[model samples]
Target: MTPAETRTAGTTPAYAKGRQRREEIVTAAASVYADAGYHGASLRAIAKRVGISHATLIYYFPDREALLAAVLERRDEEDDARGFPREPVGIGGVRHLLALAAHNARHPGIVELYVRLAAEAITPEHPAHDYFTRHYRDARDYMHSAFSAMAEGGHLREGVDPRTAAVSFIALMDGLQVQWLTNPDAVDLVSPLRFFLQQVLTTSLDQALSRQS
Candidate 1:
């Protein structure tokens, strides 16, 4: 989108109200979807949560597919808002993810929803299969670039391959989520990630995060 267009987005009263209504519906839908998986969530339920009529909800999202897509899009927007950049910059990328994990710790329902949907979307025919595919691919590549940058800058540990570390880190996050879901009180999500990064990088996670701040 053009910068000029972005600056004008949702500026008018009617357009802003429409956009606000859409965001409200998406937020409510996300909550409902988090409580109940997409298959179990219904438009009526989402509309009720948003205090809107079913017809109004349909007006905003023509169908279940559209609403589900919006929920996923809003989720990525939330992640971006949480500081998980689309293109992570060096070790700071790792720092952002760890910060995200910390954020996730306070929201187990969101973490559970993510884990559930990621598993559900493994099938080729799943509506979000492509989304998950690109999501993981982006995650892997994000970390790969970070590790690669560290290697070039002499911050990566000796004998560590960026590709391998990147893949392993993603796997670790997925596994940690599963464990944390089952034992939220016992598990320490952010620290495990911090430890993993410490093993791979010569720079302290704190030092890098502070620089980002």
Candidate 2:
């Protein structure tokens, strides 16, 4: 049996309750962090917003760092649940990324939290430092492989290297996020990604972006 299946089968009523409460706390923390930024938000404020005692909140998260991790983890869970692919293929991988951009547009709060956490995680002593480091490495590897497949399939434009395209794409997405967060009216998130794909790929960009996943 799969680990997820095993966990589901083994989960008790008390464990389920605890898990739900943890999710609630994480959601509350995400909201607090989004509104005030991570450093500006406090565990006490998060617990108060969740209507839970500070001690009880600590019993679940133990510390602010632990709760922050849970908040990021929960967002990833939500992305997966919302149809973000785990193992991405070439064109489909790009398409999935476009879908993700669309998804991020609707969840500005989560994107803001992610960007803020990412910037803060640059410090070696930060709780999420290792997480961001590993995340970028894994993401780069996956995107490089996907673009390589595109090249192999003859979908990628000439004079473009898969690794270069992958890295550039990641950079563009991150940079665009900050710009869009700064000025949503001036900077678009999804359209720029679609245009990037259009520049790299030989196929129809309109159909690609227009297709609803």
Candidate 3:
């Protein structure tokens, strides 16, 4: 039988109830963590927010780290649903990043959660250290491939190295995010990114013109 069918066919009513309750706990925990940061959030407090007892919360998550992982996973699922990485090729990837920044502006809580956890996860002992590590590595690789494709397509300026450009682009995005988080009124994330891309594309055009001249 299919997994869904099996889940409904042989699953006990209590097990189904428990599964639903666990989803509610995860949703509550995500909001708590987003507001308080992982280090400051408490399981008991999350339980209170969900109107469940502390023991019941523990029965589902067992520990803070596990709950944090679940929250991050849920965030990833939401990001995927939002059409993140909709364009994974060449300059389209750069456009996709700008679009993501625009999307982030509407979700301050999720942005705050990411910034707080990413800073904390710099420590090797942090529960999210490995997660952040893999996250950066994957992001860099994707950006690098995108830049490489642009270079191969003759869209990048002369003397521009794809790998270096990718790293710089990622750094620019992260730096802008920090600035925007600190002073949302002063920092316009999408505009700055558009200006950067315009500069890059203009330079590429100039290089092509010089080559033909």
In model 1, where do residues sit more than 4 Å from their true spots?
1-14, 203-213
Steric clashes per prediction = 0, 0, 0
lDDT of 1 by residue, 44-118 (tens): 999999898999998877788888898898889877787664667577777778877888899888887898888
Q: How do the residues 1-213 of candidate 2 rate in per-residue lDDT, one tens digit apiece? A: 544554544332245677788888888999988888778888889999889889989888767887888877777678678655477766677777777788889989888988988998899998888888977886687788779987897778899899999999888989999999999999999888878888998778766445442
Model 2 residue 50 distance off true place after TM-score fit, in angstroms: 0.6
Query: What clash count does candidate 3 reach?
Result: 0
lDDT winner: 1
The better-scoring model by lDDT among 1 and 2 is: 1
List lDDT for all candidates, in order: 0.83, 0.81, 0.76
Q: Which stretches of candidate 3 lie over 4 Å from their true place?
A: 1-14, 83-87, 203-213
The local lDDT score (0 to 100) that residue 4 gets in candidate 3 is: 58
TM values, all candidates: 0.83, 0.85, 0.83
lDDT tens readout by residue for model 3, 1-213: 544555544322246677788789888887887788888999889999899898989887768888888888877788678655444666656656777888888877778888888898999999989988987876787788777877787677687887877788777878888898899998987777666655665355324333421
